[model samples]
Target: MSALSTFANRDELIVGAFAQDLSEVAERGRATLDEEVAATAHPYSITPSSLSHS
Candidate 1:
């Protein structure tokens, strides 16, 4: 039995809490990426960009 399964049959609750935490982390990561993309001028910066060959 998993650690969560031992918690008085609250496995679903435990999983849901973890899922919510992960969702918040992902949202923050996306926001930070947006800020970085907006602040830099380097053509090949860490942010993603469409391909170009000129």
Candidate 2:
């Protein structure tokens, strides 16, 4: 997650919403990583609006 700071593009940063716990987050990450444009950073604390309702 911290490694994302090396890039100049904050636009590259995306919040993958999940439960407060990391279980859902990890699952989401694995799924997305199979794509070409995968997430480069995982924020430590996502904003309230960024949280998943599902």
Candidate 3:
């Protein structure tokens, strides 16, 4: 009985840790996407041809 309880607790702990890590990664990904969107929200006055002489 004690062994089963210990195993259950260990499994729960591992699942919790995995969930936390995944949540952190998701949050970081969302933040990165938001930053990219914000950076591209403004339009440049210059044309693509102006940027390149060729």
Candidate 4:
């Protein structure tokens, strides 16, 4: 959660770079970024419990 919360901010920065317009397409693309996130969730998930066990 900690690591993901951190990267979520970074992800905003990265996505912001490409989100420079107020067009519907841009908004739609931004609104639908969750699929990308969902696909990457497993690799990026870092729970406190996992670290404690390690």
Best model number under lDDT = 3
lDDT of 3 by residue, 1-54 (tens): 699999999999999999999999999999999999868865765757669977
Residue 7 of model 2, lDDT score = 60
lDDT of 1 by residue, 1-54 (tens): 988667857877888999999999999999999898778757665533354544
TM-score: the better of candidates 2 and 4: 4
The residue pairs in collision within model 1 are none
Considering TM-score, which of the candidate structures 1 and 3 is the better prediction for this target? 3
Query: lDDT tens string, model 2, 1-54?
Result: 575675634544432222344777787887878653435545565757679696
Of candidates 4 and 1, the better by TM-score:
1
User: Which pairs clash in the backbone of model 4?
Assistant: none
Cα lDDT over the full model 3: 0.90
Query: Weakest 10 consecutive residues, lDDT, candidate 2?
Result: 11-20
Q: Which candidate, 3 or 4, has the higher TM-score?
A: 3
lDDT tens per residue, model 4, 1-54 = 699999999999878866764466777887679677766779658867778954
Give Cα distance to truth, residue 45, candidate 2, Å. Answer: 37
Candidate with more favorable, higher lDDT: 1 or 3: 3
Q: Compare candidates 1 and 2 on TM-score and give the better one.
A: 1
Cα displacement (angstroms), candidate 3, residue 16, comes to: 0.2
Sorted on TM-score, best first, the list reads: 3, 1, 4, 2
Report how far off residue 34 is in candidate 3 (Å).
Answer: 0.3
Flag regions of model 2 displaced more than 4 Å. Answer: 1-20, 37-54
Q: What overall lDDT goes with each candidate model?
A: 0.80, 0.57, 0.90, 0.76
